[model samples]
Target chain A: MLAKRIIPCLDIKDGRTVKGVNFEGLRDAGDPVELARRYAKEGADELVFLDITATKEKRKTLVKLVEKIALELDIPFTVGGGIGSVEEIADLLHAGADKVSLNSAIVRNPDLINEASRQFGSQCIVAAVDAKSQGDQWEVFISGGSKNTGKNALKWIKEVEERGAGEILLTSMDRDGTKSGFDLELLSAVNDITSIPVIASGGAGTSQHCIDAIKKAKADAVLAASIFHFQEIEIHDLKEKLKNADIPVRETI
Target chain B: MIAIINYEAGNLASVSNALQRLTIPHTITNKESELDKADGIIFPGVGHATPAMASLRENGLDSWLKQTTKPVLGICLGMQLFYESSEEGDSEGLGVIPGRLKKFDSSQHKVPHMGWNTFSDVNAHPLVKGFGTEEYFYYVHSYYAPENEFTTASCHYINEFSSVVCRDNYMGVQFHPEKSGKEGSLLLQNFIQIVSSE
Candidate 1:
């Protein structure tokens, strides 16, 4: 059986871990490699390092950080943020990242998804979609949830899968950083339309929220930041709760 | 030293990085001379089957892989390539194992069978000496080699398939041991022990 994955998404800026509320008001978290090692020790199935840095030497710093984390962390990790070209994707994979997530890059040039998946294999390409609820439907937001792309979230999800994206990292902009719970309706809607694995992101406040995402929405994985980062919820205990709920998860060996 | 056969299949950095953490010396090479010099061969790959076989033949590693008696460990697509053929590209394999790779029926189950899955119905072998059915390994592939005479352990997704297979000196695992965390590292250590014993 394929266990439901629990992921800790780390927002990296200038080579350090940071977290922002609703994609603004960033604050220092901790050292990325150190935090990553701790998460792996506590049983995080995978880790996502979203580079929120905005420097000219950003890629260089991210590559260095990825190499450092890969050297220390045993589990798989992904690098994303401002990854525009196939060459940049190649550089990150060469630096030891097991996969790379694309957001604005793919939205700007949708062909990049096809090209990258064709070149590096779809299993390594993740399409991260930040969706915000409008009056009746959800709209796709890019540039870290600041700009709305005027694209329907469901349609974009279909397009990415058709374009060969192996996975979908779906974030709810409406519920991000609120810590209430995951947007189950949105998650279920996306899961209903796509065959590829959908990773539920944003609005993760408690272990119940994680369970709801998996049990209710049928998410293949759940990703949270502040809850795991601040020690509010230990991954070990969360896995126990998930198991108690009859959700299959990988035990920390 | 372990030589990771490099036929431009995919990234070899994670494999070499894992070995480095284990303090095992390895080299990524496409040359037959370098592979012949190594104590063990680590065959790693990712991507489609047709082009992969083409690249292997282009570099003449196919014949070398078919004949080499040295302990060889194949991971993911590398393992799939050890069979007689695969439905992925309608291409032929190295014919080292008596089976063909088949794509998971997506109508009933999700394609790619991604994430942590465990193997059970184990047969005692050095590569899986300590591994149990409770132990899980990272997997990300669409095609799989069904359970056969060469299967050492089996995992259930859409159906029972050879998650780990061994024949003589050649061993292949459908999971990425390097990316599977503690169990992954332990599996790699087991392979290191096999190579060291040789």
Candidate 2:
């Protein structure tokens, strides 16, 4: 059986990890390399580096940062934000990212997913879906959740899979950064429709919430940024709590 | 020194960086001469088997990989290429290891077995000796090679399948030790030690 994954997302800006992560042993969180090493030390199953604002000039710096982090950390890491073409995705993969997540670009050109999966592999492509609840349904949002695409969430989920996406990173815009809890209803509905692995994102406040994301939402993985960034929850402690809750997690030293 | 065969498949950086972290001298090469000089070979790959095999054939690595006798380790798609053939791209493998690759039935479990999974029915080998029998390692692949006489370790996902396989001088593992964490680092350390000893 595959163990559930607990991922800590690092929001990067101009080649630096924003929202500092401080502890006794770890260095400054401003350095992505140091933060990556620290997260690996704390037994993080995987890490996601999202370049919050990826500009044309800052792309090289971000790639260099990714290479540095990859050199020191042994765990699998993903790179997202401003991933537009297959050529760019190939370049990042060679630079040391195990996978690349696509958002707005994929929404505009769905064939990019198929082309990339053929050029690289489905396992290397992660389709990030940012959705907000609207009445009885959930609407898909893009452009870093700033613009509503006016597309149905469930329909888009199936389209990505059929277009050759390996995994879906479902983020709830309404609950993001709130730390209230995961959107269980949305996650469950998405998981029910698609057979692919769904990573539940948004609103992870406590360790119990992570458990609920797995047990209740049936998410294969739970991804959080703010909770992990503020040092409210340590990866090791969270893994321990999840293990005790009957959820099989990777054994961290 | 270990040589990571670069046949145009992605993920070579991760494998090379893992070796560097262990302080083991290694090179990422597609040249037959460099591969010939290296003590051990690590065939790293991702993506489909057809294009991967084509890349190997284009660079003349297909024949070279089959003829080499030094200890060689294959990861993910690399492991799949060791078999007689794979159903992923309907391409023929190196025939170095005696087996055929099969795709997992999504009806049984998830298509790609992504994330960490533990080992069962592990045999004593230098590469896996330092780790526990049940220690979990990260895996990300859709097609898998079935168990046979060369299977060194087995793991259960949708069904019981061979996760680690070794045939004489060639060894293969479905999981990516480079991405597996502390236990994974130890496993790579063990591989380096095995190569250095040889």
Q: Tell me what fraction of the real C-alpha contacts between chains A and B each candidate also makes.
A: 0.71, 0.86
TM-score of each: 0.97, 0.97
Error of 1 at A180 (Å): 1.0
DockQ of each candidate relative to the true complex: 0.78, 0.86
Output the lDDT of residue B31, model 1.
96
Candidate 1 positional error at A247, Å: 0.6
lDDT of 1 by residue, A35-63 (tens): 78878988999999999989999999989
Residue A62 CA displacement from its true place in model 1, Å: 1.1
Provide the lDDT at B73 for model 1.
96
The residue ranges of model 2 lying beyond 4 angstroms of the native Cα positions read: none
Q: Write the per-residue lDDT of candidate 1 for residues B1-198, one digit (tens) a residue.
A: 999998877558888888999899999999999998999999998988888899999999999999999999999999999999999869999999998899888777667788999986789999998988999899999899999999999999898999999999999999999899888889888988998898
In model 1, the Cα lDDT at residue A221 comes to: 94
List candidate 1 stretches off by more than 4 Å.
A20-29
State the displacement of the C-alpha of residue B97, model 1, in Å, after optimal TM-score superposition.
0.6
